[model samples]
Target: MNEEEIPDKNIFMMCEALNCDALTELPASYSIRSCRPDELGIWKMMPFDDADSAKEYEGFMSNYFTTTYSGKEELFFAKTLFVCDRQNKPIATCLDWKAYDEFNTIQWFKVLKKYEGQGIGRALLSIIMQRLEMCDYPVYLHTQPSSFRAIKLYSDFGFSLLSGDNFGIRKNDLDECLPILEKFMPKKYFQKLRIINVPKEFEDMVNKYDTNQF
Candidate 1:
């Protein structure tokens, strides 16, 4: 999707601990599996909300993979996952990535608009968190106000908005984003949102990166 389309403030969230009990099985007829080398195209286009957006983002996604995960293609595919239909076609994808080789961060998480409202995204995220359980604490993710649904889901998994106007190389828009969420999201979901201090270690690790290559 085009950046201008959403125009929402970007925000950061962190899960200091995994909420494994929140994990639930995918609904019948769908399954989760590691991404395959041959399915790179499927992974790239998974983030767009629909087919038209996917087509518009195809080239940009291709280059994003090239520039961001360049030398780590094998590991990237290994850490990435797909939630597929009975036919084994990917309907959603996410990555348990260690950005800058320093800290764990969720990346490229999305379920096709058509398949949403199902339990696919929750199942996929649970599996990713299960995998990260052994890797590190305080997992982080970048998102925006436009993704309030995802923010609610992330909150269910113990992720809270990271407090501050800046996080590493990126500006934190949580202050601005929260008002939007309060206005649009159900009051109950909005009430459950939490804000936590950004971990110093995470901040230091990220600030070391001179550029936001990813």
Candidate 2:
């Protein structure tokens, strides 16, 4: 139920902001910055101490207890970031991914519920967009309509949908991509979206990103 690319009102939307693409300017309020070298280990992920009831959340993220997602390499680790409050506790998070080059994307992007209204999400996203500015490739993300305001944040940052119309994934890999999608997403979500081949946006960025790695 976690890997499906199925588009759901609640499942979060999948979108991307290509490097240097024109963006709709928007003002931000919060102070957003990347984690320092020393804080990387401690600020790797959002605090989810209770792994006992992960299903109770929207995604099965809590299943993994670390600050960062599983299988991340040093490159992914350096790209992780946090939003600290006055006391320096990380209240929001975002991560960079490259396991599948074309699918190089930002994942686990969220602001703790208590910090939702202060524009922390947009600040996090804005800084993320800046990180991708030097890449010839695009920065990818996934979200859903149920998150009303989040959609606006993405659009404002120049993210647009990646569908069969705009994206064209190689046919040979469809067989391999299908299983991964099915494992995480549900069929019902795609039924409503009718967007064929979510993986079509994968742009072979794995090799392209090597030079960009810190």
> Which candidate has the top score in TM-score?
1
lDDT of 2: 0.49
**Model 1 Cα lDDT, one tens digit per residue, 52-162:** 988998988887787678899899988888889999989988887878877888988898888989888998888888887545877889989888889999999999999
Return the TM-score for each candidate structure: 0.90, 0.53
Q: How big is the RMSD of model 2?
A: 9.1
lDDT (Cα atoms) of all candidates against the true structure: 0.83, 0.49
Clashing pairs in 1: none
Return the lDDT, model 2, position 50. 38
